[model samples]
Every structure is written in structure tokens, then in C-alpha cells.
Target chain A: MSVVYGRVALIGLGLIASSMAWGMRRAGLAEEIVGTARSAQTRETAREIGLCDRVVDTAAEAVKDADLVVLAVPVGVMGAVAEEIGPHLKQGATVSDVGSVKRAVIAAVGPHIPDGVNFIPAHPLAGTEHSGPRSGFAELFDNRFCLLVPAENSDRQAVDRLRAYWEGLGANVEEMDADHHDLVLAVTSHAPHLIAYTMVGVADDLRRVTDSEVIKYSAAGFRDFTRIAASDPTMWRDVFLTNKDATLEILGRFTEELFALQRAIRTGDGDMLFDYFTRTRAIRRSIIDAGQDTDAPDFGRSKVHP
Target chain B: MSVVYGRVALIGLGLIASSMAWGMRRAGLAEEIVGTARSAQTRETAREIGLCDRVVDTAAEAVKDADLVVLAVPVGVMGAVAEEIGPHLKQGATVSDVGSVKRAVIAAVGPHIPDGVNFIPAHPLAGTEHSGPRSGFAELFDNRFCLLVPAENSDRQAVDRLRAYWEGLGANVEEMDADHHDLVLAVTSHAPHLIAYTMVGVADDLRRVTDSEVIKYSAAGFRDFTRIAASDPTMWRDVFLTNKDATLEILGRFTEELFALQRAIRTGDGDMLFDYFTRTRAIRRSIIDAGQDTDAPDFGRSKVHP
Candidate 1:
């Protein structure tokens, strides 16, 4: 395909940005790609790996003369980076972000957009436990859902162009309201991550189990929680903090349901446990049917088994 | 790789027993693997799949003259199957089980064992989300832990033979006491499974999020919980019913720790959240380093990327 934008700027050189660089290059989504990071070490790594067409020293420098600019930094720093790059954003350029929490990101970065710049917030529901510049590949976003949150009264052509660009990068783009996106993400990602983190922490704090035993026997179930818990701490921290109310709401529901199941176990309610488990199995079937996850047993990790 | 047992009787033809059939055949651990299931359909499937050397119609017929008899049924039914097979067990035979909960299985099955017969309960800490006769594989036990819980006065020779057989099946065998084994399994498998089930149930119960949204966006984190929660309903129900005290205890601790983290989130304690998450990250590294799980990104599901 042809270039979706004359030039694209990435304000962070982490997993998402590096992946975007490779994916965009693979599909020829942009004529030129400029990237920057707050950490000099990250910038050096990106440059050494040739993550983008040009590695700049600042977000402002990266945004200059760019037709499309994506803020791929942590949620906590979105506003600061937006403020720094707002004036440098070229007129008529479309500015988008890849933050997980949409409402908070829109609230944080929307004000800093210049008059002629269109700000769109997009989040791709895809990732691995690994992070940073070297941990990304071009297929990271392939067939993954990328939710686009465009402001009311925004430029229609720009939104369409950004959606096309995401399609070019191999993601299925769908428009969603920022608030609904946060709520959906809270249920699907944020609360589950917190629960995994909590379970892993509980295992770690148990003195009788011993860390070695936990590590050795983790294949039974606990290792999946550990993988989710091992995701980048800072990014997750910002996710929970920014998506606070929705996450807490879902978690509250989780605790209530957990208590009910605990009561069933205590009361020896075999039928209740069986019915609940049976219902949850259907959802897994639907996930596989939707092409969102693999139906291969154990998430296809059997290949890794010794 | 010589025959460890002249004839091994598997009392059930489910995932564990079927996998044991393949694993034993792969290593020639048993001269003959005779199997039976309470369900005729399961027995037919076993016959169709060649899951055993001989597929008998009853536990009694399967255990006749067998050197090693393994009760590979659900934990809640151990007593009945043990009672049925006890009188038929050979005088010098070894009768063991692959139940997840040791204390309960030992308590239920011990009194039924006849004189001169050895009763050793074992639990293989390995499985997948799939079940039934067709889901079995030769490598299901490969490098996974198999905990052996021998009675205080059990025969040393029988126990050693059983351990060797499991090793030949590609598992690392460890000897543990019954009560301790239950508690350890509660922490590693039972509690995590309950949490996953609870979390998945909550997501399904959420009316506002919609089922399709949860299934589509699930790759973020919820898919892992769903995969775990999709485990065989009957087996998990029996597991919770049999291992009640320890599972409830670990879950109690899990809820306590989760509440603390929730409080931190509510109070905007970023340091506490970050520190807890960072600490959990080390556990994943240890699990991977110990070779219990793969460190490849997304558990190496990247290969399935579209």
C-alpha cells in the first residue's frame, strides 16, 4: 500500500511505538517515521535498532513537520508530553494516542491540542508481558481490536484517515466513546490484571508454600497469574490510577462474586459450583470463536512443555 | 524403560488416565495398561482411541490380577471406586490414585484397601483446559511435578516403583505428606482456579459491558482467566468439595491481600501498588528460570498471530 501520512511522529519508543514503526514500515503506512523518548537510554536503543526513520531528541522536535503524531507514552505523562509538543505540531496534523485508559487520556491530553490539529485517542487491545523497544514485532497488532475515540465535532476526514492507517498496520479499528471504552477496558483488562497481581502477591507472601515450590508447581494454575502480574509495573500503575472508578467498580463486583463462590465451597454446594463453571466455559468458547484467542489447549503452551 | 508393572489398571478414562496410558506406552512403563470408566461412552472412546491395552467394562474387571491399580477418577468419588476394586486387587498389588486433593482421597480410600495391598495416593500437577479421552497426550506429564503421598506404613518397594514409573512418564516425582500436599495444592492450583472462575463469572454477569465486548477485548487479560476457568466442571467441583478447608484458607488470605491492594488503589497509594507489582514480577522470572513456564512473549502465542 501507499503512505497513509506524509510523515508520522512517535513520542515514545516503547513496545507499542516500536511495533508501530515496524508495522507501518511493513505496510508502508507512512512516508517517514520520527520517534523520541523521555529517556535517553531508550532513544539510544531505538536508534541502534533502527526503530524509526529518524530518532529525534524531543517530542517537540519529532512533531515538527509531521502529518501524524502519536503519543505512546505512559498515561501519567500524556498531558506533559502533549503540552510540550502542542505548539510544534504541524497545522492540520492528526494527533492520536495509544494509551489504555481513554477517558483519562482524553481528559489529560485533549486541551493541549492546537486549533488546526485533530486529537484522536486509540487503544489496541493487544500486548505481552514483555515491554520496551526490543520486545516488539510487526505482528503485535495483527487482527487485534483497536478502539478509536474521536471527539464530537472532530474532523471527519482525519478520523477516517487514522482508521485507515490503523487498518494498514493490521488492526481492526472500531470507534467507541471514551467513557465506554474505559468501562469496557476496566472489565476486560484492568480488573483482571489487578486480580492476577493480587493472587501472585498473596502466593509470594505465603511463608509455608516457599517461593521455589510456587515456582516449581506454578504450571498447575498460578503461572498464568504471574505472567499477567509481570507486565510493566509503571504502565499498569498508571492504568489503575487513571481508570480508578471503573476498575474499582468491576473489582467490587469481583469480590462479591468471589465471596459467593467461597460460600458455595464452604457449604459444599457442588451444583452451584458446577453451574457457574459450566457457564464460564461458554464464554471461553465464544472468545475462541470470535478469533480473539486460540482454542488450542493451554493457550497452545503445550508446545513449550518439556 | 522396562515394564515397572506387569499390568496397570486405570479406573477412569478421562484426561489424566488417558494421558497416563499414552505416557506409559511412550516410555514402556507398563507391560499392559487395562482401563475402565463408569460411563460407557468414555469406555467406547477409549477403545476407539486405543487409550489402553484392554478397555474393560468395570473397575473390578480392570483391576483383576493387575500389579498397579490407579484410581484416576474425580476426588469426590474415590471412596466408591476404591471400595469396588479393593476385593479384586492382587494380594501384592499397589493401589494409587491421581486425585488433586491428597488428604481427602487418603481418608476416603484408605479404609477400603485390603490387607497385603499397598495404598499410595499421587497427584500429577499437570493438565490443560481440555478434557475427556480425546484430549490426552503423551507429553502432558513431561517435566511437570507428580506428588506422591504414601501412608506412614506403606511398602517402600511399591512407593519407589511408582516414583520410577512417574519419572519414566516424564514427570519429576516428589514425595509429600497428605495434609501438606493438600495445602500446597490449594495455594498453587485450587485458589487460583477459583479466582479465575470468579473473575470470569463476574465479566459474564456484567450487563453493561456486553458479552461480545468482553470476548473481543479479552486478549488484554480476561482470556487467561477464561481459559483457566474453562477446566472440566465436574473435576473442579469435586476438587473444591474435597479440598474445602485449605482452599478456603488460601482464598481467605487471597481476599485479605486483595483488599489491602484495593485500599491502596482507593487511597491513591502509587508506591504501594508499584512496589507490590514489581515484587510479583520477580516471581514470574523465577518460574520461567526454573523452566516451569516459557518466557517467550505472550506465552509464545505470537506464532498464532494473524
Candidate 2:
């Protein structure tokens, strides 16, 4: 395959950036991949693991002479990193970010982009609960959706090339407006994650059920919540802060639905509960039919890994 | 292994009962296993699958000569089934159930037991979302917890024998009082399941996000909730209905914690969110260490299953 980018700069050393680097290398999408992390330890680890062709000490150095610069840092610091790398970005380069919250990222980093550069934002809707540089694998994005949110004034050619880059890395790319992306994500990801964290926190605070008991008996349903709750805290905190309104809106809906269900339980309205559950059960079938998840029993969660 | 019971009867041949039948056969723990279900179709399916040595037409016939009778029905129907089989139960026989809510089962089935029969109730903390006769598997109980809630003044010998029977089925057995068992499960399983159902219901209700969008993008976090929400609606309705107080108590705590986290998100308290997430993340590690779940990436969920 021909290289899609002569030089690709990844400005974070976490799971998403490392997986992007590996995915690009797997398909020969980038001629050279340079990455930089804010922490010296992360930079050292990236270099030691050969996560990129060159690991730089600063984001500025990483973006220099690069045709594509991916600002994959935390959403909270994306603007500062963009400010630091803005002047060093090559003219006519394409700058993209892998932030979960698109509106905030656009607001934070959009102003610093040079006139000649095309700024596009994308989010790959795929990940395991595990994070960090070592946790990445090349197959992370295979058959997954990578949403591209192009600014209204963005160049069509640049957007096409960015979509091509993601496709080359084995992601199915679709274009969505930033506002819709945030709301969709709020429904699909943000609210669910916060709910999981809240459930786990509640379990942790229960005095009657010890921590060991909760952990030991978790395989039924609580374990899945724990898996979601275990995601990188810094990343999630930034997500809730940046995508506040959409997440809150979805959560509001969730609380109302929950209260209704609770009321049914209190009132012993078994029919209502049954109908709701039956309806939601069909959605699971739809998801499996869409090839988004496995249909294997127990979600095919193996008891042991060899 | 030697036969633990000369004759065993399984009423309500659903997932748990059929699995128990297969598990007993796997360990050679029962000399003869007889089963019956209210649904004639279920009985026919059990016969076609060789689910028992004899598929009886009535619960009375199934329990006529059985030394151990397992009432593996929904919590709501246990009392009626117990009454139907009560007169036919052999003298000095041991009777147990595989209901999710122990207190409710005890309340329902306790009165119908004959003077000489030992009425011990047990709840196996394991299952797949799939249900019915064909969903049964011998390995379903392997390494999972089967909690025994012994009745007051219950025979110690009968309790020990039932525990041995479960152990022979490849489960780790522990005994708890009925109230404590209900409270513990409400914390571990019941509340989490209700929350999952509510989240999935909320997503399904959102007109802004089409069902296709929810199913396609569910891989991020909502898919897990859907898997849990796909469980048998009849069983869950019974569970939430019978274990009302404990479930409501845990959900009360959950709501309080959720509101605190929601307030933090609204107030842009990144530190609070981060700290809460970090604390819950440690619990995932604890779950992994406890061997309740695998540490395999993505819960070792297969991408494709043939």
C-alpha cells in the first residue's frame, strides 16, 4: 500500500495514539511516525517500545516537517499542545485530533491553526477497558467506526485524505457534524460510562457487602460495570467536563427512565417491566445482527485466557 | 464419583434446572434424574435432548421417589410448585431451589414442606443471558458460587449433603442466612441489572438517536448493558418484584452516589470525577485478582463466533 502521509506526528503516547501508530504501520499508511508525550516517562517508554519511528521530547519537534499531526492528548490540554505546536506545523499540513468531545476540541484548538493548515477532528468508536502504551494492539480499529467531524470551512480534499488514512488503518469512516457527534456519543458512550462508574462507586461504598464479596460475586452483571469504570480516569474526567451539556441531558433521560422502572418495581407492575426488558432484548439482537458485537453466550467472555 | 442421591427430581426444567441435571450427570452424582415442566413443549424438548433419565408428565410423578427435588422455577411460582409436589415428596427427602431471591423463595416454599422433608434453598450466582432447556450446559456452574441459604432448624446433614451435591456439580458452595443473601445479591446482581436495563431503555427511548445508530455505535459501552439487559425478562421481573426492599435500598444508595457524581460533572469538578473513577478502577483490579473475571482484553469477548 502507498503511504497516505509522508510523515505522521502523534502527540500523545496513550492507548489510542499507540494503537493508531501500530495500525498505520500494519497497513503502511505512514512513511514515518513520530510521537511525543508530555511526561518524560511516557516518552521514554514509547521510545523503548518502538511505538513510533522517532519519539520526540516536545510536541513542537514532533509536528515539524510532518504532513499529518494528530493531537491525541487529553481534551483538557489539547489547546495548550495546539498552541505549542501551531507555529511549528508545516504549511499546507493537515492537523487532526482524536478527542472524544469534538465541540470542545474545536473550540480549544481551532483558533491556533495556521490559515494554510486544514484542521479536522475525528473519534474512533473502539477501545478496550485497558489503556496505556503497552496496552495497544494493531487490530484495535478493525471493523470499528471512526467518525470524522469536518469543520464547515474545511477542505473537501483534506477531509477525503483523512478518511482515506483512517480507512487504510482498517477503520470504517463516516462523517458527522460536531453537535450530533457529541449528542450521539453522550447517548452511546458518555452517559453509560458515568453510570457504570456510579454503580461501581455505590458498590464500593456499601458496608454490608465487603469489597471482596462484591468482587467475588461480580461475574453476574457487576463485572461489566467494573470494566467500564476502570477506564482511564483522566480521560473520562475530561470527557464529562468538556461534553457536559450532552452528557447531562442524556443522563437526565436515564434518571427519569430509571425512576419509572423503580416505581414499577415498587408497585409490582410486572407487565411493564417485562415489556421494557423484552423490547431492550430485541435491541441486543439488532446489535449482534449489525455485526457490532458477538452473539456468543455470555458475550463470549471466557473464564480464562490462555 | 459416587452417586450422591439415589433419585433426583428437577421441577421447572429451565436453564438452571437443566444445567443442574447435566452437571449431576457429568459427575455421576445422581443415579436417576427425573424432570418435569409446566409447559408440555419444554418437557418434549427435555425428552428430545435426553435432559433426564425420565421426563415425567407431572411434578408429583417427578418427585414420587426422589431423594433430592430441586425446584428450579421463577421466584414467583415457587410456592405453587412446592404445594403441588409437597404431598408426593418422599419421607426424609431433601428439597432445594435455584431461585434468585432467597427470602421470597423461602417465604413461598417453606410452608408446603412435609414435616420430615428438609427445605433448604440455594441460589447459584451464575448464568448466561440465554434461557430455556436448550441453553443448559454442564460447564455453566464450574468455578461459580452456589450460595445455600439454610432454613432455621434445618438438618445439618441435609445441608452438608446438598453442599456436596453442588460441589460435585463443579461449584463452590457457601451458606448464608436468607436476609443476608438477599441483601448481598441486591448489591451485586439485582441493582446492577436494573441499572443496565434502565440505560438500555433510555437509549431505546431516545427519538433523536435512531435505533440503528444506537446498535451500530454500541461497541463503546452500551453494548455491555444490552448484553445484561437481554436476560430473561420473566426471571428479572420476578427478581425485582420479590427482592424489592434490598434492591430499592441499593438503588437508593446508587442514586445518591450518581447524583453526587452528576453534580460534580455539572460543577466542572474534574478532581472529584477523576478521584471517583480512580477509586472504582482499583475495584476492577480487585475483581480480576479474585478470579471472578478474566483480565483478558475486552473481557475476552470474541469478535466472531462460529
Candidate 3:
């Protein structure tokens, strides 16, 4: 309810940063929110939408004298953004990033941090397929988990302050080591996203099943893959590139499992397919029970559309 | 609306059948609906919920004097249900089905239709992961598609009446041949379901990533796969077994495309990955434009949850 930071700097005006700005204002978590993006159009759009208290022209200008600076850029560009704003950061300012991958982010942004500045890597496990400034809302982070990956020698006060700030923005924050966080996300997010992209691509490339037919009959199941596959391309490309090792491991496992299921289907092994399907259903139940997803049928879309 | 059928018998009491019952009642499309199921508990649930005008204990009893008999059972069990009810069907009654795989259902149920009894196969492209009589909703077919696969010599009047009945139930109707219907569904529904099941199983089998972690962080994109994987096991198992060839073909294509994407990720070929992802996004746009899915971010869960 109170200000967690006197001044907050958001270095990318994409979905995450725009959402953070809206959520921060909703909870009065920051006295002043300054935002900037690499693209002039994005910066102009943010200003036009009143997304931040101050829409600066550059990351350097945005981070100047800010008590907390968050880099919400794609993983590939975190280093450049950090180098640009490093000198402008105020003394005792905490530097953090909302990148999907933490180990790569820490590696890229760690060197630019000054002696008194704290650099903590955090990933908010929340997003929609839609991207950009206009696609964000305050409820994006509500009831979602935000993992904070802080170094061993990081300042405790700074880490706690960042945790409080995210909590104020309606996220449940938990501390995770960089390596474990990457592996966990590889299984839960990266691998699944790549698989969805692959399936959607295959559907599109099939000559026999016309594109119109694919789109028209999508509600049977493929539409869900399209939704996941529609996520920001550059962001996801960086995710796969930076988190390559862990993601490849998960994909290897996924391919092996998929081949086995395909074999079962080919061999008419009904029991294997049935057992696998039954086991996976339990995990869905656990997700609903954990409050990570809605139990309403069809993700409660019937309610939304009706 | 006037009654489309004087008496309609539903041979299976699952999500599709129950939903049809509710939709029929909502539109007054059927004067009297008779339903039956293999499991006593399902029949009990249907009776308790008043899912039909009458709940019979056997498929034979349910089809007696019925003007339209719909075999709403699993793909694998369609033949047996058809055989059981064939003798009891009225002389001029029309026999239809709501199976996922049209060719297989046609093969399985075709031989049993006595002369003068019209046999037309239909598949409705609508459902949720939830199953059972209680999961049925009148609006389940609203704005969804229903494909009709009538035999070459089939009675034209019977097919027209069935199309009108589905239209009254709030679905758009289309005529598709059984073979093309099978292939289209293999790409859109069956293969997608198998891939989702495989991904969920891989996540569950990975001991390194605890189940709690997957459940907690599923909002990152994996939850959609879980929803698809949570569909009724028996129905999906039958779908895979009956539509084996087409599904295997699609899976082959999916695996090949996935390998290409994986190679790009391994080689750090960002352009290839980005291009593939961008193309997939266009298909998602088409699906949205076609009204096959909701465009709301996160499928509009934020609104439902907030």
C-alpha cells in the first residue's frame, strides 16, 4: 500500500514493464515510474498511453537517480541495456531484470553493476500471447509466482526490498538459485513453448489440410497451440538461445517420450496410450488445486465469451 | 423453434451426448430425448440431472421407436453400440454419430444399419477437458463447427434434417467426406492431443523438476498443454487407436519440424527460430479472425480470475 521505491526505472516498455508500471500505480508501490524503450515508437506509445509518470528517451535518462532500476528487455539485450544505464544508477540503487532466463541474464548484466549496486535476477511466471505496451494490464501478475535469483554475496536489504516491491505488485515472490530456476523453467515453459511452435508450424505447412480448414476447426485442440505459438518471437528466440542447454535437455526428453507414444499408437497399444493420458490428467488436477490455473471448463472461456 | 425429431436416442452419456441433450432442450429441437450409457453410474447421473426425457438401461431400449438415433460413444465402441441398437431402430429412423474420427466411425457403424434406415456420420468440433453428464452445457456448441459425412447413396432428406438439427443446436454445419475429415482431424485434434500428452508426461516424469514446481509455475505456458491432456482418457485412447495412420502421419511431420527448430536453437540460429515463430503467429491471427478461438490475453483468464 505504501511506496516500495521513491523512484522506479523500467528500461523496456514491453508487456512486462508496462504491466509493472500499471501494477505499481495500482498499489502505490512507487512514487515515480520512469520507462524507456529501444524503439522510438514504443516510447511514444507509452507516453501516449500514460504508461509511466515519466517516459524518458533513453535507458540512461530513465535510470538517472532512480532507487530501483528493472531491465525488462529480451535476454539477448540485457547486457547492452545494463551497460547503458550502469553509470546513471544512483548510489545504493538496486538493479534487477525481468528476463525469462536468470543465469544468462546474471552473466550478461552482472559485469556492468557498480560496487554499491545490487543486481538480482527475477522472472515473473506470467504472460499472455499478446505482447507490447498496450497488451499489458495490472492483473497480469496477480496470483502468479515471481522467482527471484539473487547471488550469494548480494545485499540482503536490497533483495528483501525488491521482494516487497513485487509483492506489492500482486505477485508471490520466492527465492530460487539461478541453475535450478533455469532447469525448472526449461521443463515448465521453454520446452512446452517450443513444442507448441513446432506443432503449429507443422499444421501450417501441411499441404493437404488447407490453412482455412486448420483455422476453422482449431477449437478441437490446435487453437491452444496457436495461442502459445503466437507469443513474442524475439523474446522466445532469445529464451531458447540463452537457455539452450536446459531447454535442449527437456526437448530431448520430450522427443523420446513422444516417439514412445507414437510407437504405441502405431502398434495399437491402447493400454499404454490410456495409462499415459490418465497420468497426465492428474497433473492438471494438481495445477488447478495449486491455484496456478482455473478449474472452470475450457479455462472458463465459456463465461468470458458468453 | 419446432421439434426437429419426434424421438432422439443418445447411445452414450458423455460430454458430447450430454451437451447435445442440453442444447436440444435449450432450442426445443427434440420432442423427447432418450439416453443410455454402459456404466450404471453415468445413467444414474443422467437421470438425476434430468439430462433427457428418459434414461434407459440399454442402447436397444433407448432406440426403440426413435426417429433419430445418435451413437455418441467412443470411436472404438461405435460399432458395438450400433450393432446393439440396429435391430431396435425404427424403419425410417436416421442413425448418426458424434465421433472424432469419421472414416473409422463410418467403417465401424456402417454395416449394422438396416436397409431403409439412413446412416449419416457427423462430428462436432467442440468440447472441454471435463467429461461426464454433469459437464454438459447447452452453449457448448455455440459458434462451433459440426461436420457431416453422408454416404453417396444416403437419403438427402435425412442429411438435411440432421443439418437443420445441428444448426438449431447453435453450430455451423459443413459437409466433409469421411477420409478428408479424418485427415483434417488428425492434424488439428488427434496429433495435437498426443503432443500435449507427451509434453505433460515428460514434465511429470522429470524428477529434477518437482511436480510442485511444474504446478506452481505452469502459468508460464505449460498449463494449456495440461488442459488438453486432461481430456477423457478412454475417449482419447479410442481416438488414437482408430485414427492411427493419419495421427501417426501428423506426428511424423510434427517431429520433423520440431527437430528443425531444435537444430536452430542448438546452432544459435536466431533468424530461423524467429521466422518460424513469426509464421506461426500469423496462423494464430487467422484462427482469431475466423472466430475459432478467443483473442483475449491468457484466454481471458485474468478477467475470470480478477
TM-score per prediction, in order, is 0.97, 0.97, 0.97
Q: Which stretches of candidate 2 lie over 4 Å from their true place?
A: A297-306, B298-306
DockQ score of each predicted structure, in the order shown: 0.63, 0.66, 0.66
TM-score of chain A of 2: 0.97
The local lDDT score (0 to 100) that residue B135 gets in candidate 3 is 83
TM-score computed on alpha carbons, candidate 2? 0.97
Candidate 3, residues B71-174, lDDT tens digits: the string is: 98888988988888888889999999999998888888999999989999999998888889888888888888999999999899999999999999989999
Docking outcome class, model 3:
medium
State residue A39's C-alpha deviation in candidate 2, in Å: 1.1
Q: Which portions of model 1 show Cα errors greater than 4 Å?
A: A297-306, B297-306
Better of 1 and 2 by DockQ: 2
User: What C-alpha lDDT, on a 0 to 100 scale, does residue B211 get in candidate 3?
Assistant: 92
The true-structure Cα RMSD of candidate 1 reads 2.4
DockQ, prediction 3: 0.66
Error of 1 at A150 (Å): 0.7
Query: Candidate 1: lDDT of B294?
Result: 75
Look at candidate 3 and tell me the lDDT of residue B173: 99
**CAPRI class of candidate 2:** medium
Taking the tens digit of each residue's C-alpha lDDT, what string does model 2 give over B1-306? 779999999999888888888889889999999999999999999999999999989999999989999998888999999999999999999999999999889888999999999999998988878889988888778888999999779999999999999999988999999999898899889999999999999998899989999988887889899999999999999999999999999999999998998899999999999999999999999998887777675452222123
- Per-candidate Cα lDDT values, in order, are 0.89, 0.90, 0.90
